[model samples]
Target: MTSVPRRTLNEAVTRFWSLAAPAYDFSALQRWAYRPPQDEVITLLRDHKCRRIVDVACGTGILADRIQRELKTEQVYGVDMSDGMLRQAMARSGDVQWLRAPAEKLPFDDGALDAVVTTSAFHFFDQAAALREFRRVLEPGGIAAVATLAPHQPPLLSRFIDSSRSLAHNPAPDEMRALFTDAGFEVADQHRVRRPLWTRMFTDRITVGVRSA
Candidate 1:
């Protein structure tokens, strides 16, 4: 499939996060801003058997901390494009390895990871490029659990995001899944769970997939 224009998407993301960095922590506009439910999501990750997990687009290390607490893994790494966000994440949790990088380009060796998880940040990716990167870094049979809030559900969050002069765009699940398939992952499960309005903007669905051997 043809890819979206890189320069356009990069510029949009850069501007969006750059302006968002200062007030981002206090912004209720992010899909899920609360803490407890995020712990529940981490519990789900712990149930999986894989070790050596990588959290892509791991903004503020919400999921990373949970991984460190719940899972007995050899390594837990977090990667994001925004340095300011990474700084906040690093400050919050010093145990996990935080890297400043885009999801589309990972620095790890091929087939280095056992599992990959992301929460509420999939839509920002250039889907195809990010998935290809996931496929490249993930070992065969490695699982990827990606979570994103639905665009149609949360009116308040939607309104706030729409009002944000910097946020360029957001995509639906179908569009996101298509990119996953295009990158050669076989989707194994898709689940939707309702979260409190104060906790998150809308209900979140977690999609799990595996790279074929």
Candidate 2:
């Protein structure tokens, strides 16, 4: 498959989300659809006792809110490029530090974060650059969780994938693993989990890695 140009992909994603922002909060379909799997991801982080977390590509702060509530850490921060999405996220309850920044170039010091988590946003990123940035921001032995829609998934997810065909750039699982490994993160766990497709079609794959100390 031919790779999409970075400038074109970024522009498309920004425009799509910017226009979708107004209707975004009203999309109860997104909440019920994504909550279960997001909860599962949070559980995984809890199991690892992750705090001082950075939620990369954190659209609307769903995962960031959960991390703050569940972990009760003041260290929660979120980064995204879309101002519209970031505005919606800031409106959400919790003191999450939201930054308008791209995942490919995080605005944090090297080895500053304890854990990093991203949900449903990997496919929109420049994966290699984003993974390298994740490595740069994470402290030694810090955990990183990157989740996105799996390829050839159920119809529910396939619809979103198709709708965003202009913007979606999902890499195969092995390719994702290689990106992380090449960035100095050891692939600790990688797998798919099933969840109810409540609204807006929910199907996802999660990858967890640790920065080598």
Candidate 3:
């Protein structure tokens, strides 16, 4: 697939969330496609005792809010590229540290976070840079969990998703594993979880990796 110019793509994404901000929550687009299996992902973080957690691409701050609610004492940060989305997130979840930032260039100190969670947002990121940045911010032995739509899909539906104008490329299992390894992370786990989407089964996947010391 051909790449869209970086600036243009960023602008388009920003405008998209800006325009969709108000109706983002109510829209099926958010619930049907964008949301991930966050309940289980949050369980993973809690089970691992991750304290400093950041939810990358935390649209409207759902997962971040849930994380804050579940682990009351932990620090939960939400980062997104659109100010509009961050605004909504801040309004909904006042305690979360909502920042306007890109995934590839996070604004955090090196080895500062205990865990990094990306829910349904990895496919939209510049995968290579995102993996490197994730490794950069996480502490040694830090856990990283990425919950996203399945890469392998039914043929026609897969084409529909791939051809979608706003969507990005999805990496197959092997590619995702390789990305984590190349980013200096140890691939610890990979699995699938079923999410209900409009009465249909969305067999999403998750990959957990650890940043080596």
How many clashes (backbone N, Cα, C below 3 Å) per candidate?
0, 0, 0
lDDT, candidate 1, at 191: 65
The C-alpha TM-scores of every prediction are 0.80, 0.88, 0.89
lDDT of 2 by residue, 22-119 (tens): 77656565666566557777898789887788998887877888789888888899888888888889999558999988888999999999888888
lDDT of the candidates, in the order given: 0.72, 0.80, 0.82
lDDT of 1: 0.72
Deviation of model 3 at 111, angstroms: 0.4
> lDDT: which is higher, 2 or 3?
3
Q: Where does candidate 2 stray beyond 4 Å?
A: 1-3, 154-165, 197-202
Give the TM-score (vs. native) of candidate 1. Answer: 0.80
- Backbone clashes in model 2, listed as residue pairs: none
Q: 98-118 in candidate 3: lDDT tens per residue?
A: 998998899999998999999
In the range 1-213, model 1's lDDT, one tens digit per residue, is 124467676666666675666676674644455343355557666666777888887877767867876785669999888776787888888789999888889879999998887876776676677888898999998887777666565666666443354242344667657767888799887766556656544566777788988
lDDT of 1 at 125: 73
lDDT (0-100) at residue 15 of candidate 1?
A: 63
**Comparing 2 and 3 on TM-score, the stronger one:** 3
Show where candidate 1 strays beyond 4 Å.
1-4, 26-37, 159-171, 197-201
TM-score of structure candidate 2 = 0.88
Q: For residue 175, give model 2's deviation from the true position in Å.
A: 1.9
Question: In model 1, what is the error at residue 188, expressed in angstroms?
Answer: 1.2
